[model samples]
Target: MNETSNNTVIDERSDILETLAKHRHFLRFTTRDLTDEQAGQRTTASELCLGGLIKHVTSTERNWADFIQRGPAAMGDFKNMTEADFAKRADDFRMLPGDTLAGVLAAYEEVAAATDKLVADLPDLNASHPLPEAPWFEPGARWSARRVLLHIIAETAQHSGHADIIRESLDGAKSMG
Candidate 1:
């Protein structure tokens, strides 16, 4: 069934997809009329920029979707990450050399398409995988695909708000009134 089917009853997957799409729209809207340099410009005390926010969100969504399919292996062992590893990961929050706003948005769209297909095709949302070994996650915890979807939605929504702030600070444009 369509994610936005007119039927009275909507499935959990459709709801998840719809919520995700809405947040994605808000996030992308924040980039409207921005040049590559503008998109990469840090608008506030925080290090976040519009293009970087999109880049981070795209990577995050792709990883979580992989986790839903391939278990904790999808997330590399964080316990042994070197300082350089962390520094490299931190690059996701910046628009590096040759990075363009259009390119970043294109990558996000690609990831989003793949994630949507995975959600629609997954055999069971109840299927779960162990949490990766990370300080932020509970030890020995597992997450259902449903939980991952919720997490993705939350992540997208939170970043969308951040993007709005960055966009407004960059100039006076607001994603929403």
Candidate 2:
């Protein structure tokens, strides 16, 4: 490849990697130095908790990487799926106590690996994928594989921000400099 093309590829890969790193960092941050109760504790009135966030992220990764991309979804996708019917399974996404920190992290890693492989194998970022759950998603939209990856990254980053605040409230731990 020419220097310009090489640089662009490098920049794109770097951006993707950085996004993944940030997600991993926050997962670790949220789980750090917490008792089992604290990890599972719903610190606020909302459904947010350190463990729940981890499970939610894992599910999100599987959705974007597998359901949207037409690949195999990791086991963590079923975190809170018992109450869901077949139709509800198509749209329901929540975390349950069964989704322990370790299990969720492992599932996230598996989905992340699949995501990396998908990105690497794609011929270009413009490559599009079919949306089986299209109606449940935004209006007038199908997503490219690249778009799904970026969306996962963006979603993780946003949840990480929430994790940061919750972690602080729990014990005042700051992000590493």
Candidate 3:
């Protein structure tokens, strides 16, 4: 994908964008022919639904992209989060009222576009940001924009697999043979 920024065509990010798009496609493919109720239904004991997985991936990508641009502040203080914060975070994996599969997919597409645009326009992927204070991260650790992109790719790919399982359980459909 060649993106024009300030009258300059940027293609350096095409590989990354294409890779991400492929994963996103697989995730969305699992929802084909699914109704809103089916998308929201928990197929397995894991409490994961197709729409919820898409929602979670969308939120994660947006947050990570923000982290790439605004540093750790974008994620807020995870270490200081309250129980309510944790509860709210869990909402990402739920298909809340009024959420439709179409809406969830649309949001994911929007986030994907924004992230791709950021990758294309970003001045330096090597620019680093100190990670937020979270249990999963090592203290004093930092990540470059490129690292953040990889993290996003990993998260999307991982969740795509989860979605595939959920979809298969919901129906006989399979994302892959």
Candidate 4:
């Protein structure tokens, strides 16, 4: 690659890494002062709580890293999955009974590691992967692996903001910074 193209690639990668780091920072902050109950408690009507958000983020990372990029054949027949599949996945976001705060954190850590490996091993930012049969994504449109990574980073950051607000409302704790 030419110097300019090389610089662009470096810049893009840096941005992706920075976004991931920001999400991880906020996630850690949200979990900072919470007891196990507080972490798992749903303060509002929303399905997301601190722990739930962690679980959701971790699962999303795994889905993107393992299923979406690598292929979905191992997970079973996703060929005919529809909007219901998306809804079912969304409905599964809640923290189940016996899911501990530590478990959620550990899962997030593992997902983060997997995501790091995916990003590191990716050949190019523009390489695209076919979106599985899901409503949220176009059926045949390809998604760049870099874009997927960035999307995960963005999604985590957004949920971490929610966690910060919920954590504050649950108790007067404020660690959003």
Candidate with top TM-score is 1
Q: How does each model score on TM-score?
A: 0.94, 0.74, 0.92, 0.82
All candidates in order of TM-score, best leading: 1, 3, 4, 2
Residue 172 miss distance in model 4 (angstroms): 1.9
Model 3 gets an lDDT of 0.89
Clashing residue pairs, candidate 1?
Answer: none
Candidate 2: where is the Cα deviation over 4 Å? Answer: 1-7, 71-98, 130-136
Q: lDDT tens digits, residues 1-177, model 3?
A: 223453332454676788899999999999999999999999788988898899999999999999999999999998789999999888899899999999999999999999989997888777899999999999999999888998999999999999999988988899999
lDDT of each: 0.91, 0.66, 0.89, 0.75
In model 4, how many backbone clashes occur? 0
lDDT at 116, model 3 = 89
Give the lowest summed-lDDT range of ten residues in model 4. 67-76
Candidate 2 structure quality by residue, lDDT tens digits, 56-102: 77767777766444532322333344555454443223345464567
Better of 2 and 3 by TM-score: 3
Q: For residues 112-166, what per-residue lDDT tens digits would candidate 1 score against the true structure?
A: 9999999888877778999988999999899999899999999999999999988
Q: What is the overall TM-score of model 4 with all chains considered together?
A: 0.82
- The per-residue C-alpha lDDT of model 1 at residue 59 equals 94
lDDT for model 2: 0.66
Across residues 1-177, which tens digit of lDDT does each residue of candidate 4 receive? 743368777787677877797778788788885677878788888877888888888877787777546654434456576898867677446667788788889878887877776666666767666666655567686777777777788788888888888888898787644
In candidate 1, which residue ranges exceed 4 Å CA deviation? 1-10
